[model samples]
Target: MLDFAIFAVTFVIILVGAVLYLYPSSRRASGIPGLNPTDEKDGNLQDIVNRGSLHEFLVSLHQEFGSVASFWFGRRPVVSLGSVEQLRQHINPNHTTDSFETMLKSLLGYQSGMGGGANETVIRKKVYESAINNTLKNNFPLVLKLVEELVGKWKSFPEAQHTPLCAHLLGLAMKTVTQLALGERFRDDTEVISFRKNHDAIWSEIGKGYLDGSLEKSCSRKGHYDEALSEMESVLLTVAKERKAQRKQTVFVDSLLQSSLTERQIMEDCMVFTLAGCVITANLCIWALHFLSTSEDVQEKLYQELEDVLGSDPVSLDKIPQLRYCQQVLNETVRTAKLTPVAARLQEVEGKVDQHVIPKETLVIYALGVVLQDSDTWSTPYRFDPDRFEEESARKSFCLLGFSGNQTCPELRFAYTVATVLLSTLVRQLKLHKLKGQVMEVRSELVSTPKDETWITISRRRKHGEQQQN
Candidate 1:
């Protein structure tokens, strides 16, 4: 089911693209009046594409088109909610992570009975969350070991040299997730490398399907995606079969395999999360670093918080809470960078948010990028200011649609755990400096990244002459 749906989406998208080329999409709104907050502005495919960058384009749409608007991606109609109230009304109760429960069910092969509301599934998710949280803490040593290697390499770099943060962070996230997901076998460096390549291929193809229409037009590209997926599933299935009876196993895949779901369902979810974690977590880590490097004051504050809390001690679960400044920095980075720019949810039932009437089965997208930067919600929405999060009310009042941990992004806390550990460990040893040409520009995708590779230079902290012992 997962495989078919993946290909089916690609095929349908391609067909739609062809149809649009032969016959341009009409300007008339398929949705109701207030539904298009854009007020029936320029939502043509030509305009969205002509804007060059979709992220910038959406930002413009919200600026020009009111807070609510409807648009089309090929034949698919989409409604974007960009304001705090609009998002709150729609997303607070109606938002979902990775689309709605039914989509997740169908894509992940959950039987009709299991759903987001299902007691058994909910219990299983909670159990997995607890287990994973504990494992991340107990497993700090593994994370630190990797961090030390990265730190060592950074310390080796000459002053003012550039380092590819995206590549490094992606590697760190992939290794950390795999080691936890497939223990013992993680030492298989060759297998780990294979997973990374295959993972990147599929993720890239999915992103490309929307931009270049290659997945729909090119059979070879689609075949490549299929092949990479097969390789990934084989690795996951092998790990699951090997560790099925290993009660000591406690990674994500192990938890899913132990659940009441079918074997195929477990395998699909494992594959989805493995790649999902790498992409989103990698983006988060790199963006956090970018924000830190750009702001010397914020960097010092983060370093001070680390020293004040840990004082050269290795980062651990207990110390995580005290890293308040670190948490604020991450929150600020995600908001400023708009790491998760776009997420869509299907309106299962006809509903109304404010004056807008949403029809059943409509795709309601929340432009987190727009909401995260709303002038009404954020005092200086465009600025990179972690201190804004200094006020507890800031985080509470403003709903970071896609980054919120509740339903929009279930993996946020998980990403937070991974990011906090990485930041605390590195900030303790090195002072992050932005490279000469490296500016943090948002390159939006499934998960956003800096427009260019975020290059940063590292130097031993002035205060900490010698690195403290773990």
Candidate 2:
């Protein structure tokens, strides 16, 4: 009897040890609170699906687990920081690259030597940043021309016509980003429409593919996505090849061609810029217009700021900085829209957050959307009040999340300038009004966009400086 008991005890110990080794729970990761893997292979993926999106998942996780939480991403464990305090502990401004780049690259399935190593990443990052800066500085006139074209289209519409705000802005943003980032080839309507069609197909699939592994499961869907992506690549390749042969560097693509980057590297970075630039710019402008439509006071204040800054002249790049109230409105729009819901950084080495030790090489998420809406961080977090940003502390808090300052991505900086030019030009000439009984619902994915087509009406402003009646 004693011998039998000893053998049974030894067998149970081995089995338990094997189980723990194969599946380490969140408790094993740290003292932080979070969900464990529901399935041995899937981890918390099903939970993410149940919660709708990664953004929504983080929202619920932070709500339940306080400022810091941990959850398994397949076999990998992810730590999410959802408060300014948690972010401050984790962010190192000196670090060259961030989780946003890493995550974006993964989602796009971009395979290149870009960001392959520390030194390569730093060099490429600088070139990419310079490209955007040069494009914006050299191409301000092009931006104005595009904005003017959009304003002209709006002017041609009937006074009470219900305008498709999201669609119109998306097309405008695509045209602006494509022309500025790619080349004047985008100036042709046929090329722009073709590129936009391919872009929409690819973008629509990317987020859904990343979340559910649906692309791999559905062969037809994956094939269509690849076809669209191939078309986009073809367009970029032709443009890049053309730019390489040209003597003068004119647009964003020209900057890349002038660099020592390989053709593949150039394509990778340009793809990043083009995809992120269009989506972010379009959604930012959409939310800005939607918010403006809902608030007449905000709209009037913005117009007054524009009037004071430039009575009848258009928004110039130099004049952009002087429109402080306009900047606040954009800042508030980003905050309220939660434009980018989440960004992640791989923990280079083991790090500490408050009392917890983050594992080395762990994927650390900056739950930016949650932090943006945190009641502790903002007063009446749901309110779309631009006045809140008038305070220095509010701006500082925003900068910490990588929305502003040196940390802002190249695309975001470019988008802000484009948005400022577009908004300032539009608001000065038109009175924007929301359609009756139109309820705007947010569909938060890689970007936060309206769930349905948003419609608005516009009336021309009088030359006497009087606001037009909606």
Candidate 3:
């Protein structure tokens, strides 16, 4: 027993000594200039393992460390950026290749395949753009129809009761996006519904596991993710098989079948498109509605804008560009809420910025939540102010919220359209109000949403006679 105890103590001492000697921090007493790893005092390390809440930790680091700071997740070194200018510099097309997408591939356990070579990346971008154009052209009416359906459902509920904005938005987004991307044949099909539910469940688990630093220990989550992927592949494969049999060519599945991508690649891309669109679009709409409920003035202003442009007629794709304030509101909501808060990347080559040398293969993170709210970049950062985006200069700076440049999300165009159409329809027809004295708490999981599920009482607007009576 004495010998075993002595051996264990010696082993621990040797292990600690080895870690101290070989760790990246040990190799250099000080980090490269302009970039230093966040210490324990900044709450960097603790944030990773804490119950999946990273917003406060990230905000604290930015307040303390300025734009660039490094931190460790176990043995992995991560650098976080808080400035849009610095993030833009790193994401320049000339400098890198789809950093976040590459990181996503690793996270999803897909083969990198030479990081989707430059040519392939460019092709994919064009294909994605074409897909967006096709989807909007073919499905805007369907999206509006879904909105109408939701509104009809809302009207049936008692005026004293509030609708579950988050769940309703999630269901609407899933139905609309699935119908648009996969076509009506699979829209409400049992297999499709099952695939979506299982995939969403898995993704939610994976996101929670990652934020909690328990991704490796989440065998159930891993199983769910793997099962979801397999089921998704089966669905897409069936679609491909059906399309081939009918000699019919639709946009998404047909495009995938014709591409040089393998079966797995096709499945992954399809999954990314379908699942990402649902979560992001749904969350964005939910947050927008939540804010609108709290800010009656903003909602009235938006209604006026919608009235001026849409004029009580059913919304069409052509009128989308004319709803300028609606667009701004969505932009501000995304900026304030930051649905996709932090994006991670790995430096593929050694790069120099200011006084620091970022070594190759180092993990870099761009905290959109921090950068979007930086005092230097935004005025009245905490306020829900859409007017700030009315100016050209402000809009230009706001472009960093991921709609322009090479780093932009491929589905952003689609997301914007979906959100605008839905918001315009709802605000124009419904009088939505927050429950009295109810404070909606923001919850951060895969995305930020209201904690209590964004309960809001919505009623159809009266046709002037009822308004006069009131």
Candidate 4:
């Protein structure tokens, strides 16, 4: 009997060891709170995916499981830092840049030695920032030009016509960014038109379905993607060659030409920024219009700011700072829309947030959208009130992630500047009206977008039109 008991104890010990090794994610984040195992009845992947909009689902997680929560993204454990404290601990900005930025670099394959390693990456990053940073003045005219083109196009349609706002916004942003990045050739090149079509096709077919392997699984899409991507590469490479030979101008492509990075490197960076900027900027315009369409009072206030700031003068850098209320409207727009709902960072070493351990090389998500509207952080978190940003104390209370926080990304700033330009131009001349009986639902894509067409009628703002005519 004694010998049988010893053998049974030894067998149990071995089995327990095997189980722990096989399912390390369970123990890796056992201390964190999240969905009950039973709640995830259909497996973690399916449960999270089916939870309606990602914004709503994340809000539910924060409400039910507190701020710091963990879940399985497939077989791996993924922790979401949903509280300000959790974000501070895990997202030590002084030590590392935004994980979302890093994730972007990795996804766009920018980190892969553009010919070298850390130094190469750093050099390219500096070039990108420098190229874009000095362009507000240079780009403003291009933006105005594009907005005028868009305005004329909108006016061509019959009165009170429903134009697809997202598509138009996408064109405005794409034209602006590409013109800034590539240069004057964008104005007349036939390849520019071809590239835009390819870029949009990639967004519809590949951008939304990238993670699910649907991109790779569908032979038809895969072929279409490859052909489009290849053609885009050819066009960009041709442009790069021309830029390399030309007078050294200060455009993004010119700055890239001055770098030691390979042609492929420059092309990829341009592609990434153009693709990202198009989606985010377009969404910004779409949501800002949607909110303004529903709220006439807000529109009237915004128009007042534009009138006070410019008084029929052209939009310029010097005048931008004086439009505080327009800035507030934008702040409110980003807050309500949750433009970038989630951004992930790969933890290079083991770290802890709120006593919860983050294992090495684990992908950790910063729930910016959830934190932005956290009841503990914002007053009347669900309301779309721009005045909330009127107080300095409100901003200091919690970080707005990529919006106005001190550590906000440059891309976000670029989008903000572009959106402001568009709004200033439009609001000064047009009045936007929401479609009657149409309810808008936001779908979680690479960026969040309305499920229904952003249906709205645009008419010239009567008073402003009279001012313009005079």
Predicted structure with the largest TM-score when compared to the true one:
2
Where is model 3 more than 4 Å wrong at Cα? Answer: 1-21, 25-47, 93-100, 111-116, 404-407, 463-470
Residues 156-201 of candidate 4: C-alpha lDDT, one tens digit per residue: 7665699788878877787787788788787764745776888877
**lDDT tens digits by residue: candidate 3, 267-365:** 676666777777778888888888888888998899998888888797788888888888889888888887777667777777655566678877777
- Model 1 agreement with the true structure over 26-77: per-residue lDDT tens digits: 3324444322222222334445556654556677877776888776655556
**After TM-score superposition, what is the CA distance of residue 404 in candidate 4 from its true location, in Å?**
1.9
Give all candidates' CA lDDT scores.
0.70, 0.86, 0.70, 0.73
Q: Residue by residue across 1-470, what tens digits does model 2's lDDT show?
A: 99999999999998899888786752345657788878677788888888888899999999898899988887778899999988987886326775566678777876424646777878888999999999998999988988898899999999889999888889888988999888888889999889888888888877657665557778898889999989888878888998788755878999999899888878878888888899999999999999999999999999999999998898888898999998899899999999988887777778999999987888888899999999999999999999999999899999888888888877888889999998889988888998999988888877898999999999887767676556
Candidate 3 has its poorest 10 consecutive residues by lDDT at 34-43
Q: Clash pairs of candidate 1? A: 36-69, 37-68, 37-69
Residue pairs in clash, model 2: 99-344
**Which scores better on lDDT, 2 or 4?**
2
**Candidate 4 lDDT score relative to the true structure:** 0.73
Q: Kindly give the stretch of ten consecutive residues in candidate 2 with the minimal lDDT sum.
A: 23-32
Best by lDDT: 2
After best superposition, candidate 4 residue 175: deviation in angstroms? 1.2
